[model samples]
Each structure stands twice: as structure tokens, then as C-alpha cells.
Target: MSALALLDYASVFVFALTGALVASRAQLDIVGFVFIACITAVGGGTVRDVILDRPVFWVANPNFIIVASVAAFVVFFTAHLLESRYRTILWIDALALAVAVPAGVAAAVAMESVWPIILIMGVATGCFGGLMRDVVCNEVPLVLKQGELYVTCAFAGAGAAVVLLTLGQPLPLALIGCAAVTLALRVGSMAFGWRLPVYKSRPPRV
Candidate 1:
């Protein structure tokens, strides 16, 4: 399989796990688990492909859907074995974000997209799936979490890829740079409390 296909599979499986975990938290049934998992697996890629006017990934290959459903089914039966589903899902979600960003970068670059569009596609691929998952599950989207570095990390990673390409770096190195930056920033945000400043409300003057 191609690297892009591998990347998509990794993104789908991990994101599906996180989605099913959220479904478990929501106390939903098997159908719900599969629903959320499939959505989370393909949501961002679907949007990216649609915007780029390319064939949607899952539509072209239904194996992606099968993989996502399998993940959800497995998680449904075994999620309780994990000590802390919340923590598990958070880290898995981070991994999914990292993997998905590079996949997006590769697609946009292959299509000869400009640097800005590349960046947007990267962020969209990394974020939109989880955003949809959270919204459907009635949880706050991680990308919109207060002062969180989620979306920022994706953009920075995509920017890194653009920079590497502009510097004449090879495509492989550029993708590695994208994944490394995205994972590093996301891990730092979660492990080291890194954050952007949030607007604080001020009292009205008398």
C-alpha cells in the first residue's frame, strides 16, 4: 500500500477508537458506536476531498469504513478494560490529529495547491473529524477548547511542511516534519500545559 493509504488507515482507526470511546461515555449502544466511529474516521477527509474536487477517500475505498466499524465494534466490547477511557481517547485523538495532518498535506501538495491551501487542508483534515465527532456527541470540540493548542498545532505543522518544501527538502522529509511538529505541539499542550492566551472578561465601567 502507498504511504498515503497507510496514513489514512492509521488516521481512521485511531480516530474511530476515540469516537467510540466518546460514545461509550455517552452511554450509547452498538449502533451509536459505529455511527460516531465512522463519522470521526472519514469526516475531515470527506470535507477535504470535496473542497479539493477529488474523489472522497472512503467513497473510493469502502475498506476505510469497514476498518472504522471494526474499531468501534471492538471498542464497544472492550473499552471498559482501559483504566481511564478519557485519557486513552485524548492521547489517541492526538495521534490521529498528527497522522491526519500529513495525509492532508500530501494530498494538497500532490494536487499542486498553493502553500495557503495546503495549510488549510492540513488543518481541516486534522481537525474537522474530531470537531464533528464532538459536536455529534455533545462534547466541546477540542479545536475550540479554550486556549487549547489543537488547531494551532495543525497549522504550525502544515506551515512546517510548506517551509521544508520551499527549502527544496524532499517530500518524505516534509511529511515527517509535518507529523513531528504537529505531534510535538499537541503533546506539549497536553503534557506541559502549553496554551495560547484566552480573552478574559473585564468588568463594565461605572
Candidate 2:
């Protein structure tokens, strides 16, 4: 398989893990775990593919479904041991975002999409999976939360990739470099509590 295809599978597996972890946290059943995992693994890519008029990737290659199901089953059997470390989902999902954003950009670039569409695809691919996972789990979507810097991190990395491509950098180098930038910024935020400034609404008049 190509490097990009490998990255896509890896990202799906990681994202599936996050979804299964969430299902465990919510005390859901095995079916719930698998369902959540499937949606989280492919939700973003499905949306991007639909928007881009490409065949839905998992539909096109059912091996992705098998990969996600296996990931969910693994998490289901092992999640009990990691209950206390559930926050690991954040790190895992962050890494997946780094991979998926570049994957999305590459897909758009492959189609000769405009730079803006590339950036949009990157952010959607990185974020929408987690959004669907959270929504299904009845939690607020992290990307929509104030100051989380989730979408910002994806945007920065995707923007970097676009710039490098524009400057004639090789695709592999651009993909790796952009993914690195995203992973660093995201992990740094997790480690250092990095956050964007919040808007403070003025007090209501008495």
C-alpha cells in the first residue's frame, strides 16, 4: 500500500480507539463500542469524500471497516485496564488528527482542488470524526469548545502543507512536515495547557 493509504488506515484505527474508549467511559455495550468506533473512524473522510464527489472511502475499500472493527474490539477487551487513563484518548486522537489532516489535504491536492478547499478538507478530516464521537457520546464537541485550539492546530498544519506545495516541495516531505507541525502543536497544547483567549461577555444591565 502507498504511504498515504497506510496513514489513512492508521488514522482510522487510532480514531476508532478513541471512540471505543468513549463508549467504555459511557458504560456502553459491545455493539455501542463498535458503532461509535465505526462512525468516528470514517465520519470525517466520508464527509470529505461526499463533498469532493469521490466514492466514500470505506465503501470503496471495505478493509477499512474491518480495521475499525478490530480496533473497537481490542479497545473493548482492554479498556477496563485503562479506565483511569481514559484521557489517553486525547493524545491518541491528537495523533490521528495530525495524520488525517495531511491525508485530507493530499486527497484534495490529488484532485487539483483550490488551496482553500484543501485547507477546509484538512480541517474537516482532522476534526469531524471526533465531533461525531463526542456528539454520539453526549459530550460537547471538543473542537467547538472555547480555546481548545483543535481546529486551529489542523488549520496551521494544513496551511503549512499548502504553502510548501505552492513552493514546490515534494509531496511526501510536505505531508510529513505538516503532520509533524500539527502533532507538535497539539501535544504541546495538551502538555502546557495552551489555550486561545476567551471572549468575555459584558455583564448584563441590571
Candidate 3:
């Protein structure tokens, strides 16, 4: 398979794992776990394709569905055994976000989109799956929450990709830069518990 195809498959696997983990936490059945996993794996790409007016990539290539299904099954069966190791799962999730952000940016750039549009598409392709997954799992979406540098990291990576592309960098180098920066930011956030400050409201009068 091509590098891009491999990237997509990796993204699908990790996102499917994330969804399955969430479902397991929610005490979902096997079928529900798989359903959530499949949606999380493909949600971002589907949104990107719809917005771009392109044929959804997974619809054109059945391998994506096959891989996602297999991954969902694997995670669904194993999630309980893995629950105590949530740290590992979080690491995998971070890696997925790192890889997916640049992959999405590369896809947009491959289509020759303008920089602004590329950035927007990149963020959509990066975050939509996680957003859907969280909503389905009844959690506040990470990006929408006050804490964590989730979508900010995505935006940073996507913006970096666009800038590098505009500067005439090779695609491989640009993508690497984007992915590396994203991973660093995410890992740092996890290690440092980095979060946007919460707003405080004034006390109500008695």
C-alpha cells in the first residue's frame, strides 16, 4: 500500500481503539462498541469528503471499512482486559491525533486547496472523529472543553503544514514537521497537565 494509504489505516486503527475504549467504559455491548469504533474511525474523513465535494475515500476504497471493522472487533473483545492500562490507551490516542492531523493536512494540500482552506480542512479531518466519539460516549468533546491543548495542537500542526507547503518544502518534510510538532505538543500537555485556565464567575449577592 501507498504511504498515504498506510497512514489512513493507522489512523483508523487508533481512532477505533479510542472509541472502543470509551464504549467499554460506558459498558456498551460488543455491537455497540464496534458501531462507535467504526463511526469514530471514519467520521472525520467522511466530513472532510463531504465538505470538499469529493467522493468519500472509504466509499471508493473498501479496505478502510475492512480495517476499521477488524480493529473494532479486536478492541471490543480486548478492552476490558486493557482497562487498567488506560495510560497506554491515552498514549495511543495521542499518537493517533498527531498522525491524523498531518495526514489530513497532506490530503488537503494534495487536493491543491488554498492555505486557509487547507488549515480548516485539516482541523476538521483531525478533530471530527474525536468529537463524534465523545458525543456518542456522553462526554464533553475534548476540543470543546476548557482544559487540554487538544484542538490547539491540531491547529498548530495544520497551520505549520500550510506554511511549510507555501514555503515550497517537500511534502514528506512538511508532513513530518507537522506530525512531530503535534505529537510534541500533545505529549507535553499530558506530561505537564497543560490546560487552558478555567474562568471564574463572581459570587452571587446574598
CA error at residue 118 for candidate 1, angstroms: 0.4
How far is 14's C-alpha from truth in model 3 (Å)? 0.7
lDDT of 1 by residue, 1-206 (tens): 87778889999999999999999999999999999999999999999999999999999999999999999999999999999998898899999999999999988987899999999999999999999999999998888877679999999999999999999999889989999999999999999989888777688644
lDDT of 2 by residue, 1-206 (tens): 87667878988999999988888889888888999999999999988899999988898899999999999999989887874645788888898899999988888887799999999998999999999999988988878766667888999999999999999999888888889988988888888878677666689745
- Clashing residue pairs found in predicted model 2: none
Q: What ranges in model 1 sit over 4 Å off?
A: 204-206
Off by over 4 Å in 3: 83-89, 195-206
Q: How well does model 1 score by local distance difference test?
A: 0.93
TM-score of each: 0.95, 0.94, 0.90
Give the candidates in order of lDDT, highest first: 1, 2, 3
Clashes of each: 0, 0, 0
Model 3 weakest lDDT span, ten residues long:
80-89
lDDT of each: 0.93, 0.88, 0.81
